[model samples]
Target: MIHSVANTDWQLASTAPLLRRGLCSLAQPLVSQTQRASRFVFAEPTIQLIVSGQLDLSTVHHHITMPASDALLFIQPHTCADIGNFRSIFLSISHSVVETLPRGFANTQTTQSISKSDSPFSTLALDADLSSALQYVISAIEDSQMSEARLRLRLQDLLMALAEKGNTFHNGNPETTTAKLRAMISEEPSKHWTAQSAGKALAMSPATLRRRLAEENTRFEHLLVDIRMHHAMMLFQTTNWHLSRIAEACGYRSTVRFNERFQERFGAVV
Candidate 1:
């Protein structure tokens, strides 16, 4: 099913759906709001693409929302929405495969999730190439019904996307403690991530990175949260996986805790 709404003066958003390998699914919908989305529960993981406009996901969970150029990957854990505008292409994936995502690569993002202050994640933004990937995923869903093999190949390509941070943010090898910190979040989006754990990976103490980011006007906790959100978004956008795996892959000791904290932060749930 394709759902979209827009005016003759503007390009309306739209989407489609497909089942692949009996293991995954693809869905796209261009929601222009005009109305509030009903509260519903999904039993599969999902990849959401924001083709244009904005989405106000005010009730799924903790402040969870994405706008133009932003996308979200949602695992099938029961979810309920208060209200939202469908301004993007939303894909519903499978929780089983989503759980297969290696912990080494969970939280991936093209644009950073910035906070109220001049934080780094806040500065990140989506570009054309990344947008192309979203389009490809949508197209695959539209035609995926024709062949399982084709859909599998396309899905592989989509998975690679999670590891890339985009040329726009490319700055050569991230070899220092900061880069190592990034790897922990992007490479192992989950696994009980903490300031101390991150420090240990970089062969330093938690106190060290905390001090380092502090010198640069940041904190270990803040950076850690950014990494979590980043990968969470990637998980929501790429694979049709489960919420349990998404939480653990991203380092939550408990899936329930993961959902609670995630909703608390993003203001939505999946």
Candidate 2:
């Protein structure tokens, strides 16, 4: 089953079933929006299917692109990428999914194959087995009657198939407090977030939270605005909501203020 995003309903197509080992979502940019130098933190391994558009990404060491129908794989966790893209299908591999692989599942030669790559991510065409596996996952998503156990099995099959091609996701490093903060706020950007409130949510004192964020060279206020601005971009690209409504949804009551922040963050206007 594929999640659908339309121009006007405002659902934003965020309800793709997040299975234990995997999750799938469609990225259809209804508007012609191109973001520049946007930082993306990947908590887990992710693969993108360039269904009908291209994607350009820059990391610390590499810059790569995938044309239409090309597939890109990111095996490293706690990594970041700056992307420029439009239409694509993204599937994420859970850390535990790779951690649970049977012993001897990945041989030395196959492991070297990934290590030989200069970049954490690789680009390739979809093989027959992988294509079939993706289709099975989609079918399972559409079938609401599909059992959770069955879906997990299907996801395992898909990942195993990828492993056979020498592309395997590994367990990610522990997430930093900054990363954790971003994830928490992204879940509901419209919420009224303050240092004290966010600190409570993360089980830290407000002062401790501020200290941790400063150690990471960031501030609590910065992360909140960053998360909200990114959410605004998603809504702008995926939905047909007006600026005022989008601003409200992102915890802003004044459209002018929201526009000012967005312009400062992305250097663009909606």
TM-score of 2: 0.76
TM-score of each: 0.40, 0.76
Q: What would the per-residue lDDT of candidate 1 be over residues 101-141, giving only the tens digit for each residue?
A: 44545343433321122211111233455445555655665
RMSD of each: 13.0, 5.1
Predicted candidate 2 versus true structure: per-residue lDDT over 68-97, tens digit per residue:
653545447656777776555656555555
Measured by lDDT, the strongest candidate is 2
On the 0 to 100 scale, the lDDT of residue 149 in model 1 is 60
lDDT of 2 at 260: 95
Candidate 1 lDDT (Cα, whole model)?
Answer: 0.49
Q: Which residue pairs of candidate 2 clash? A: 1-138, 1-142
